[model samples]
Target: MNTYQTLLVSTLFSSALLFSATSHAIELPQLQQRWAEIKYQQTGKQQESAYQALLTEASAARAEHANDANYLIWEGIIRSTYAGAVGGLSALSEVKAARKLFEQAIELDANALDGSAYTSLGSLYYQVPGWPVGFGSDKKAREYLLKGLAVNPNGIDANYFYGDFLLQQKDYQAAIAAFEKALAAPDRPGREQADLGRRQEIMQALSLAQQKAK
Candidate 1:
């Protein structure tokens, strides 16, 4: 190849790489929106299908950005959501896969996405069964939740999930405090619907904890 032809080929290859990166950037926000929609889905079948699709997309994104903590976290979140939608023994397997993804994200950057991995992993530890069935552990759950809070004291998810763990531990007053903090958390741009749903969850849990205390 002559000098001019080699230069032209190199330019084209760089342009293609730029385009691919830009396309993935555009797709990431859409994936987040799809995840929000999946959260509010009313039926199990719909949730299962939506989450399955999201899983495929997120997995592809993770592959493209193998070292990106954010992509890995989203992949883990999608997988965990799919597991919840398909609850049963099989769900445990899915959660385990999600766990590994979250662990990898933490290994890369535990503070990525405002400590999202910690909150998700903490929730997994608490929600999954323990002993003969699964790898759940109250101790690990609290540890992760506290780490999440240390990084993001005012984060809505950090507060809410920590509060939830407290409620399970029967610490009603502490749970109420955490839920209140979650309710007072600042609204995130482009996340209005998710914030609303999370607020509802916080309120319900707060009410239940309050009732239990009485």
Candidate 2:
């Protein structure tokens, strides 16, 4: 081929590769697995270098698969993980970014995963301190949580957060019911063993709520 024709072909090939990389869909299960590992590392107070590397890789995957709402959701979740690892101003920034990304994902696909975005947003609102003050907002928290439950009654995060909110509100019976629902949720993401462990924890929480009710 002529020199100019070869150069043109090379450019086209490079462009194609770039497009393919950017348009690829991130694997949701793999992202969740990595996130769980990050969480474990944080809990153990171990070096998080590997977790950081995993986040970088996951971020790249999400960027490549920008069209996938789940990819966006995972990206937001990883950002929240990074926030927890690095406390202070950086953590706040990361969480804020995470919230925005999650909101975007919901806007893009509200009905995805039976309204996972609602669950995520509900948790964020419930957990995050209030603006111009602290993060405790039982009323607003309950509002979002209830909204999420309306979308998906069996949603894990929604049930868990709402249960906590109810406990805080001194509505022990409601708290117990919420936690029991969380434990019974069938589609939680994570390793099988880890999922079972979480269910057990939720059950324990339910028991506590039951005691409080009595």
Question: lDDT per model, in order?
Answer: 0.90, 0.72
Top candidate, metric TM-score:
1
Which regions in candidate 2 have their CA more than 4 angstroms from the true location?
A: 1-26, 40-50, 85-89, 133-137, 187-194
| Candidate 1 local lDDT, 1-214, one digit each (tens) | 9999999999999999998776663256677778888887556787888788778888878888899999888888889888888998989988999999999999999999999999999999999999889999999999999999998999999999999999999999999999999999999988887898889999999999999989
Off by over 4 Å in 1: 1-26
What does candidate 2's lDDT look like per residue over 122-188, in tens digits?
6666566677533436566666667778888886666886887788678898898889888878865
Considering summed lDDT, which 10 consecutive residues are worst modelled in model 1?
Answer: 21-30
Model 1 steric clash pairs: none
How close is every model to the real structure, measured as TM-score?
Answer: 0.87, 0.75
